[model samples]
Target: MAELANCPKCNALFMRGPATVCKDCVKREEEEFQTVYAFVRQRQNRTATVEDIVRGTGVEEHKIREFVRSKRLHPAQFPSLSYGCEKCGADIREGRLCSNCTEEIQNGIQQQDQLNDIQERNKKKDLGNATYYSMKRDKR
Candidate 1:
């Protein structure tokens, strides 16, 4: 379903559908993609990184990253093309985080879980050892 939306690039009012950007922005992006692709497909430039693509083609870094993320520019074909990991800003070709950051986060979660388990066990032990006694009072 197409709905009226403001173009993110040019801020023009347009109908939204499969494309998040308006038609003009889309066409402009397509031209930019072609320029970037042409630069990259050259023998010497085949191994160009995202930064190199931005510099060589004069395309925005974010747009090139989007191209890679969307697989409009396949990383497999262009070996040196990669985008920054969301967590650490390290170069990554696939997911949001690089392997090191992903592992670090996973390990942190595991350690936190272990600590929580230990705390729970300690609480249970303390409850079991707690003494509760009823006091008997003489009626006056």
Candidate 2:
């Protein structure tokens, strides 16, 4: 089912379909894509980076990165084609983040989990320590 959405390019209201953008923007984008493709498809241009393509094709870097991320342009086939890591801004071929940032995030999560486990164990111990027993039975 198509949903109503604002086009990302022109901010126009449109029916959402397989594409995230509206029809008009899609047309423009297709032209831009073709321009970029033509520039990169040349033998000497096959290994062009995102910036180089943007300069050569007069296309936006974000759009080129978008194409790369969407697999419209394969990075493996074109070496030096990469986008920035979402966190560290380092060049990366795939995913939102580079390996270093991803590993750092995973390590941080593991540390947090360890801390949570320690806190839980401490809580359980405190509950055990808070227990009290009555000695009145000895008086009987």
TM-scores, one per candidate = 0.85, 0.83
Deviation from native of the Cα of residue 112 in model 1, angstroms: 0.7
Best by TM-score: 1
lDDT tens digits by residue: candidate 1, 1-140: 89999998899999999999999988998999999999999999999888888888899999898888888888999999888899888888998899999999999999999999999999999999999999999999
Model 2: per-residue lDDT, tens digit, 16-76? 9898999999899999999998998899999888878988989999989888888898898
Model 2: how far residue 105 lies from native, Å: 0.8
Per-model CA lDDT versus the true structure: 0.91, 0.90
Runs with alpha carbons beyond 4 Å of true place in candidate 1: 137-140
Best by lDDT: 1
